[model samples]
Target: MLKYGVTHRLSTTYHPQTSGQVEVSNRGLKRILERTVGENRASWSDKLDDALWAFRTAFKTPIGCTPYKLVYGKACHLPIELEHKAYWALKHCNYDLKTAGDHRKVQLNELNELRDQAYENSLIYKEKTKRLHDSKIKNSVFNIGDRVLLFNSRLKIFSGKLKTCWTGPFTIAQVFPYGIVELSSTNGPNFKVNGHRLKQYFGGDIPPMVVPDLQTFPMDQ
Candidate 1:
């Protein structure tokens, strides 16, 4: 990648949001493979090419175009187009070597514009998605000296079903902007954690209940 001047980004462990696009693509590919392989699970490798072609040719809402079209500056010719002698198929079939070369050059020249438009469309789509997500998020408010429970996300893998994942009645030592919180525990040092991981801890002493003495009349004994 360095040889090609491409920059590489590493995502943090357990944080899928850092690489959301790659995660979504993997999920889509898994679904496509599942549908294509059906009961022939062992033949998934054989159907890989078909699955890839389908994915590349399918329209993406974010980009507002097929992946193949964005990369090649033209839509892919479907098998049906060849079988039915579509206009695109016939136009390319009649082109001589020089004519085909010139046509390809024209497409390559327009490739940059196509990519720019796709980029803009993707930005708009992401903005709308972020807005929708933000609309449903209820902002958590925390104050200094308040008690809160810290969620132990790391315990998810090996913990038993009945085990509680929340680990703390930590005191909120400081509240920072952008969902950052500093917490202090009784036996541990103060530390900063994401505010989302903390929830208001309502732990306190419960009042003792008093029962009045009951007087019984002489029984039938």
Candidate 2:
């Protein structure tokens, strides 16, 4: 339907159920917001925004910079004075910026230097982040004739048809190193499919690999 102007596929489940922790956190956060924000459901949305604000400002591993700082070069100030002081130490003081105003060119130059440095640091930070984050996935690649689970997040039921966000531990007929493999059903004929839509099936209980690294390199002798 590309000619008919279709843009994207709507799904009840798009992202794989790789991490149960994220789902559990969402559930717990719901209970927390509900109990504390009693009878104010509409206002509950603000709690999520606040939670995101807090989370993005918190220290991130590997990169050594928060998502907030990586994005905007600073963190938000909490209402508590000590938290403000802490943030000043973490961000503003590092650059030696006294205030938005009340600054001379020397301080301005220093702040500008820090600001530019932070941006440069962010690139290194982002790469390190990706390296650490992607290290596990890079180890999870499969070869030809491997088994996999294809995701069927296609909203395939109205009432009693079916409801499985995933399908198969199907056999791999062909493997493409770019994280794409040709999948085939075990007990049926309809198996040839794209590998990008599939995941490594680590049985039913264990979660599929989140990020699979398929970068191949020449052997060292």
Candidate 3:
């Protein structure tokens, strides 16, 4: 209901599954009421009425309804004169649920199908990514000071911090296959980096260096 962010299954004593939006909201509302009813804290009920008024007037996105409208079908019609009015709202009208077992049963069935599909999809994506990584590794062989672009992706790195693109035209100072690539920093003379991180760039293949064979003189025995 809190939009499309990926929901998690893990809930611990320390990590309860609640949105920060709700948490901060309650805290702020309480603080506002506490301030307005300072010393006479018991009169917070009066301040809460004003807070509710303020909250209802605020705007929200995606659903495009204020808290007031979400609870009540329409905005509160504030009276300029001393007449008190009651705010009324219509219930959320969507028929997303039915009698007893229907909603739960349908949801359970849908989730089961999603879980199975996710498991199968996971394997497919895993193998595809692995093949890509292996192919790159097999084709790549880095040498010193060879500049190349880094393949940056949080999904690929899994660290969620590595640059997804445009990290280095970093120079390769050393090479260690299947592991690290010692790279030189783009900075001053003090800069250096991992060998495995370095990529080799050929400035248009300058044909492999050829060497001439020299015949050795035979000595008389």
lDDT of each: 0.82, 0.59, 0.54
Give the poorly placed runs of model 3, Cα more than 4 Å off: 1-8, 61-63, 81-221
| Model 1 agreement with the true structure over 26-116: per-residue lDDT tens digits | 8888899998896869999998898888999999988889999899988788779889989977766645889878888898999999999
Q: Identify the leading candidate in terms of lDDT.
A: 1
Model 2 worst lDDT run, 10 consecutive residues: 9-18
TM-score of each: 0.67, 0.38, 0.28
What is the C-alpha lDDT profile of model 3 across 40-142, one tens digit per residue?
7788887887887776667644235465644544444555422442333222222455642464455456655554554566556556655775576545566
Tens digits of per-residue lDDT for model 2 on 56-113?
6767543466666556545545557455567455554334455554544445456555
Comparing 1 and 2 on lDDT, the stronger one: 1
lDDT of 3 at 106: 57
What ranking emerges by TM-score with the best candidate at the front?
A: 1, 2, 3
Show where candidate 1 strays beyond 4 Å: 1-13, 40-46, 78-80, 91-94, 143-146, 150-167, 170-194, 207-221
